[model samples]
Target chain A: MTNQKLYHAHIEACVEAMNACNLSYVANLKEYNLEKLCECIRITRECAEICSFTAQSLSQGSQFAGEIAELCAKVCEACIAECAKHNNQHSRECIEACRHCVEMCKDLMVAA
Target chain B: MTNQKLYHAHIEACVEAMNACNLSYVANLKEYNLEKLCECIRITRECAEICSFTAQSLSQGSQFAGEIAELCAKVCEACIAECAKHNNQHSRECIEACRHCVEMCKDLMVAA
Candidate 1:
């Protein structure tokens, strides 16, 4: 795939993951699991922001693309691990998205 | 400050950075500097997502809190470095936000 296409795909996946995690956290707020809920929101937001940045950076192949991709993979992995602790559907979906994004970021980093 | 407060603040800063970077890229599109634009988007997205995730994790102190914080700091630093390369106001703002978030994440990690 062209660099632009690949980067776009990666960005979309990252956004999806962030949205999933964010929605899950908000929807499950009544669960009253403050700790887990908070973690979910924070991690989701983080992923969403970074994914957006990475997408933009990749579009232009900035001097920082390779470095950003490396960091993106690391953060995505961390988010995935955290979300996996919860036994809820939302968490599960978020984890899956994060994992997918992580793989994409790794590929991009390698290509960079 | 309370963990929740700190996490919230960090998330806001991260979001702001992402928005700034995104807007900058869009506004400067006529510049047609594809490589720089792409990189900005990618890095901004990545930072935003990871920052969101980190915020959530810190709010609840997940089992992965410390680990996530560590990763968050690293990613934020990377993003800051990338954004700093540009002389644009948007990039400078992003760099500032990322730096702020990095410090906050570090504090949270230490407290974790």
Candidate 2:
């Protein structure tokens, strides 16, 4: 894929991850056993924020896009690891989105 | 001031900066002299995103809050520099907000 195509794909993946992580974070907060899911909630929220920022920076073609992508990938990986410990639907979705985001971020980095 | 107070203050400053940057970015996009304000628009958008993410991360007490704050300060500085070149009301507000954010970020880092 062209660099432009890779950029677009990466942005899409970041958005997807952002949405999923947000949803999972909210869901985790609403859980009765909040203590057990504290890390999950925190990581998911952090991942969502990073993913959203990365997508916005990429859309603007900002000079910091590469740095933002690197952070996004790292956050996504952390989110995936945390969410993978859970079996809920939201966590599953978050993990899947985060995994996709990590892959896209790597591809975008390579293309850069 | 306590660390918690500083964190809350930093988050507030980041939110203010984000709002100002977003407003300035949108206003710049509507300007007739689009070519001259292109850098202003781009930097404002990037600054807004970073400020937003930094605020969210700080609010969540995320482990990466420090890193996000660093990036937020950097982006806010860039926005301030770019907006200072423009003599519009929106740019003025953006510069003020970004300057405040940078100060708050510095304080938070020192407290850390």
Give me the TM-scores for chain A across all models, comma-separated: 0.80, 0.90
Tens-digit per-residue lDDT, A1-112, candidate 2: 1222236667667767876786687677768998899999888878877887776566545556666778889989888888888998989988999999999887766656
lDDT of 1: 0.65
Best by lDDT: 2
Q: For residues B1-55, could you state the per-residue lDDT of candidate 2 as single tens digits?
A: 1223236677667767876787687677768989999998889988887877776
What ranges in model 1 sit over 4 Å off? A1-3, A28-30, B1-112
> Candidate 2 i-RMS (Å)?
6.7
TM-score of each: 0.48, 0.53
Per-residue lDDT tens digits for candidate 1, residues A1-112, read 1334346566656555555555555555657668656776677667656765675566543667778878877777877877777788877877888788888878777777
C-alpha lDDT score of every prediction, in listed order: 0.65, 0.76
Give the range where candidate 2 chain B is weakest over 10 consecutive residues by summed lDDT. B1-10
- Please give me the DockQ of candidate 2 compared with the native complex: 0.07
Report clash pairs, candidate 2.
none
lDDT of 1 by residue, B4-77 (tens): 43355555555445445454544445466767667766776676667666644544435576678789889878
